[model samples]
Target: MLAGKYSTLGAMPTERTFAMIKPDGVRRGLTAEILRRIELKGYRTVGLKLYQIPRETAESHYGEHSAKPFFGELVDFITSGPVVAIALEGENAIAGWRSMMGATNPANAAPGTIRGDFATSVGENVTHGSDSPESAQRELALFFAEGELLK
Candidate 1:
């Protein structure tokens, strides 16, 4: 019975990705539901934490946007409250998480997506997922140490 259930383990290539429930999403109490949806998608949670983002870390996290005029706002908003940081492992996890998160703007996000159902605007768009494997590696390392994640 157990082996049968595990038969599909190698059916698809597995990858790791990072995801974050931004401050607005955490404040709105959507953490549990968001995690539920992720698990339902067959991804395994390797690491999870809820904590306030330090200013320095937030800045580093958004380093690519440092020259943007709205960069300060991005830092401020992310550091305003507690956020959920998660490391997930599954088949094509990077792309899978992004698809599940939907468009950057909730207004255009399709229904049934996390942002589509929970976000009200681009500024408060509920979630963040790594856009590629390299990005996933960088972001995951920033939020979680090597020994901190489950194997």
Candidate 2:
């Protein structure tokens, strides 16, 4: 379910997207800067945690990429260190967070975006954002359990 905000009139529905500061980003101490950008853009952080991802969880999370040649590398990188998983709520959060994350390949990302500024390579790209609403819901469920999210 989408996260909702209460207004004077009634409940105003808002989108919830999943975002992660990859091991590289966290190791580089970019977590605060990245989170600041999200909050500065007016997204609410409903849930957050820094934890080492288990192999099974990572496999499920990246299940769609199972057939790809780089799948094992992707899983290995993600589980290499602690990552910060966050649940963000806002209007058009899925797209919004993606925009903030910049291009998947840091070489191609623009100067002002997170990846552009922090990442040096595609394999070590510093963040992850849900590409669509459906993915957001599934991702959020994967990282957070019931009652973990704030109202």
lDDT of 1 by residue, 88-113 (tens): 99998988899999999998999999
User: In lDDT terms, which candidate is top?
Assistant: 1
Candidate 2, residues 1-151: lDDT per residue as tens digits? 2344434345345799999999999999999999999999999999999989999999999999999999999999999999999999987788888998999999889999999999989999999999988899999999999999999
Global Cα lDDT for candidate 1: 0.94
Predictions in order: lDDT? 0.94, 0.93
Instruction: Tell me each candidate's RMSD, in Å, in order.
Output: 3.1, 5.1
List clash counts for every candidate, in order. 0, 0
Error of 1 at 13 (Å): 2.0
Off by over 4 Å in 1: 1-11
